[model samples]
Target: MADHRRPPPDILVIGAGLAGIACALDLSRAGLSVELLESSDGVGGRMRTDRKDGFLLDRGFQVFNTAYPQVKRRVSLRDLCLRPFTPGLLARTSTRLVRIADPIRRPGDAASLMPGRVLSARDLAALAALTTRDVLLPASILKRLPDRSTAAALTRAGISLSAAEELLRPFLSGVFLEDELETSARFFHMVWRSMARGNLCLPAAGIGAVPEQLAAGLPDGTLRLEAPVVTVTDSGVLLQDGSERPASTIVVATDGPTAACLLPGLTVPDGRTVTTYYHAADTSPLAEPTLVVDSSRAVLNTCVLTEVAPSYAPPGTALVSTSVLNDDRPGGEAVVRRRLAELYGTDTSAWTLIGAYIVEDALPAMVPPWPVSRTTRFAPDRYVCGDHRATGSVQGALASGTRAAREVLADLARQ
Candidate 1:
């Protein structure tokens, strides 16, 4: 059972998530014998999708930004058949629903973005200035400018506290899975730049399709699912079934916590939690594929998923997805329903609750002074990489994986 008769693989990647898949692909591309092991039944750690009653429920509310350089390099957007959300979002204020469309993209809605109760002239100018700077300047310039909490950066940019609380906070809280806006300003600006340059989209299949595509490109027998690794040593890894598989190199490409578990003394940042609730309705609430946020902060954000991707639901049915920052307290769904009704201006008494997914480690908490990218070289033969080592985004995960492969290749060349 030790498989001692066979030669060891050149590289062993413990995890088949995006990072591991990317790493294994690159390593194999360099003609190295690589083996990727995953404990789960399938890949796509947090990006899995499930089919329930003819509805496709993504493990969490996730979107793909078309502008990420790694994504453009690795993923086939045209093949994914991406469906874009409306260019802007709607915020439900106390008196009325406010629409802030991208005037440059949607000139027709430029009038709708005029100064209003929620966004004053000062707020408008500040927002415009911030957008222009983020969009026009190189990311290196922004990362080097200064680091602070997002709240302070908003104030520094001249965004009014009221405007931030009403619009930016509610919208970004869902994105970062934090309410206090304590995330790093460097991360916020990078996200802002991506948003300005890209369109947020969902694949026609589901978010899981992204990983499935990456895994599909791997060499045969390079990936092994359901192979749980219990221990990792300098020489090889021990499997849960008491089998030992040796390798010349090992990369801990799992999530932050799992990687820490396998590699003792590894330090990982705190993580953020989020829960997404899916509800099925007979009729669609919003005709357009736009996101709706409650200024009251009752729920982070909600959208009609069926509007964006019809394949997510069966014929004649509408699927709505709502997300909360953390594991909602007991009886929170009722409150969310009431808030959704208010935001959509419709009755939800008859809507059917499909599923609620709680992701305890939705993303790594990116506080100030956090390195935008961390070195993946854990040791001469051991390496670690994931979103935790970089910013929390698809771009981060893939870039970390690519970086890990490059390091591994360099080390092997020396050997």
Candidate 2:
């Protein structure tokens, strides 16, 4: 028989996603007995990977920015074996495909930008100024700027309406998973700054490798998978199987909806949905790892993943990933494949449909007046942390976890 009077762990973090893993690691490193529980069979809640017919298909199209401060602090870059995408976008117009490369990252490609091709000279200058201001200035200043819709910010920054519709709208729609571009201007600036300062890449294995890497660094016996936590009480968590695990502290690190279900009265913000379709072909359509956006707003974005990392697909075959804002249509995959054919100017009918994943709660919507950071200390010894509590990004999740850990550490010291 087990003894119920046994002392509980110092901290119990629910959800083995990046947030929970980060918090557990921080507390454990400080000589505290930490127990991390995950409901799923494995780690990485949304950042999951699936294998189909010798192809690596990520749950959704996700990219890692090397400039995230929390990522650099927690995970080692070289270990993931990242492959970077070209620092520009190829916009598919009705007539032809236009390539726009960043002058800072691809200096040689910048020379191909003829005046009035994508943007007029004045609009290009305005874009350069916006990039310089966001990338060069400290983040503190960008955060202090008034919060507004990203569309409004572009207008205020002198980006012409045509440029906004042609260049920024389709590209950013994929980033935010919305066509309105109503995300917070501050959040947009931070994302742009991160992109400007870092390489956009994917792990050789998959996006799931990120959380797996974080979980690997934890102390032995610190993490437990397949532990579905149903309720989060003051003392600790109640497992679905009627097992009670007590702890001195608790942190709900699950997604917004799951976190809200566990903790009553917690408000779960509305989330954005996205769908990704994977296709395999005999030959590569685009020979570069450049993201292609439909200027006509037909599809979100498409990229040949094999161009970035040949390991993503089997030898002699190319893997392409196409993402569209989730509409919950009955035959969305067929529509996506047809659009791919039009975008790549190739016959996608022969391309094998590898997989289609529709993530309902892809990310929390970050409209104007969204908080970049939120209080993790919900109650004295109780807390909550996820991308929902802050900006909806990997950086947000890791940062919120780090903040929760600090809060727990400080509260424990006071006791």
Candidate 3:
């Protein structure tokens, strides 16, 4: 019998975001030598945290849908803290504001929600179809589905044209972050499955703490910050400070466009921006911590924050997150604050403006022709990973990292 102990690796992981961290941690656990290099001064790329004048702010306001696997495995519910969304909702329809309390754990919640006052019988039927028949339809070839994406399916199902534009399209765009025609048909099905499980959640402390905690768990010196990687050679990466580091395997886990620049033949299919206006003084502008969405509004689609997470703000202060959709961000911080005042009313004076986190290229293409598919999967030794690599969320980044780590583990197993 052979004494089979696997050989160690000079493993290199590029970018220190969640994906890179995940890969490094897993690889280290497997007894492989792992090094995670980050371009920024610290870890957590898009999910970076900003602390100034007493506020913990994430570079972008991200809401993790319940679909993530890390929620069960990696993300320690004890470390940072978390708050799940309520089953019911509060939606700002054109004519009325509907408050569906207990949306997550309730029945007939949608039926009981208000705002549908403006909806016609056709609109109601279409809304039901979008959630039930269209988005949730099985993507399997064995399961027959309507011809179009949820938006198109609604149209095919005799949903009135006005309803699609005024209601469904706006609501869907906020979630998909793209126009109805551009979104992939399959993505909605995934969302439906997650929604059936639960709504969403926010870190009880701050978004930055989640990524920071993961980094803390890794062996010391595994993660290196401010290591600007100019270009990733087949063997390893060339640093900006005029040093080259080599390893048996490398993972490009930087931002999408940034990754494209680092690796040849990587193109960003489509991009989107997420703009947030932070008011440090506004603690309780809205009566509840529900996600405020106005289907009739175009630019400023949705708003949510750490209202439920009491520790996120000062004793009576609040941090409000407002998102404007576009390939190009409209204006700077001033524009966002103006919109906040317009939507939430003067009562917003309770909170002061602490920071403005504008993620120019927020979400990568989770739809298709899937963006991840086009990236030439740099074979056996070299690799790429990020939110852009998998499903485009914190979980995607983690899963992609775990995937790359497993790849290295397999090679070790063989060695």
- State residue 283's C-alpha deviation in candidate 3, in Å: 5.1
lDDT of 2 by residue, 169-189 (tens): 989999998998999999999
| Candidate 2 residue pairs in backbone clash | none
Mark the 10 consecutive residues where model 2 has the least summed lDDT: 1-10
Model 1 lDDT vs. the true structure?
A: 0.90
The candidate with the higher lDDT, 1 or 3, is 1
Order of all candidates by TM-score, from best down to worst?
1, 2, 3
List where candidate 2 sits over 4 angstroms from the true fold.
Answer: 1-7
Model 1: lDDT of residue 190: 92
Taking the tens digit of each residue's C-alpha lDDT, what string does model 3 give over 1-415?
Answer: 1112323237878888888888888888877788778878887888776777666677766665555566568877656557765654455556555553443366556556444455666666555565565335453431233233556555666778776665556656667666654555455545555565555777776677778888998887787788788877765667888777777777787778887887778665456676665666544666556776655554445344656566666666666766666424444555556655655665443456676665776776555444322232566676777767665566567877788777667766887
Better of 1 and 2 by TM-score: 1
Looking at model 1, residue 16 earns an lDDT score of: 88
Q: If scored against the real structure, what TM-score would every candidate get?
A: 0.97, 0.97, 0.82
Q: Which candidate's lDDT is highest? A: 1
lDDT of 1 by residue, 1-415 (tens): 5757456898899998888999999999999999899999999888888999899999989998999989999998998999999999998765688887988888998888778745798999999999999999998898787799999999999999888988899889988889999999999999999999999999999999999999999999888899999999767899998888998699999999999999998999999999899999999999999999877777889999999999999999999999987745778888888888988989998999999999987899999987788889987799999999988999889989999999999888887
